[model samples]
Target: MSVSEIEKYGKINNMYKVFLDIDESSESNVKPMLTNIASKWLELPNGFLASNTMDGDEIYIPNLHMINLVIGN
Candidate 1:
């Protein structure tokens, strides 16, 4: 899948991390599918933080190590 396909429903932060709400019908229910796609497009290591919310499933890619280094955090 192309990054544009994912980005169509995702919010990309300035730090290049991606935040996406789960859509099992459109994508896969498995978290790894989305994380792998996000990681490949965003050029980060493959990983994600998932949460179940009242609204839906939320996936957060935290490339914080790179961001922290860049910002001197």
Candidate 2:
């Protein structure tokens, strides 16, 4: 499905906080795509963090190899 459609109809609930997560390696060159995806999924003007860490000490560990998106309403 298109990004816009996915975002518009994606489910959101207490069990999910995000509908999609696109991981681009620290050296990948897909800023445009990432931006497009992020813009489409995150409709609210809020803060977001995209980071990678070897040590798992935060709520999000993008570098630990865990990949999934939480969708909540």
CA-RMSD of model 2? 12.8
Most accurate candidate by lDDT: 1
Clashes of each: 0, 10
Model 1, residue 73: displacement in angstroms?
Answer: 31
Give one digit per residue, the lDDT tens place, for model 2 in 1-73: 1232233224633222224433435324343434533332222233333323324323332232221333232
TM-score of 1: 0.20
Model 2, global lDDT: 0.32
| C-alpha TM-scores of all predictions | 0.20, 0.18
lDDT of 1 by residue, 28-60 (tens): 444445453233222224433333331343334
Model 1 has an lDDT value of 0.34
- Model 1 ranges with Cα > 4 A deviation: 5-14, 17-26, 34-73
Cα distance off (Å), candidate 2, residue 56: 32
Task: Please report, in order, the local distance difference test score of every candidate based on alpha carbons.
Answer: 0.34, 0.32
RMSD in order of candidates:
13.9, 12.8
Best by the TM-score measure: 1
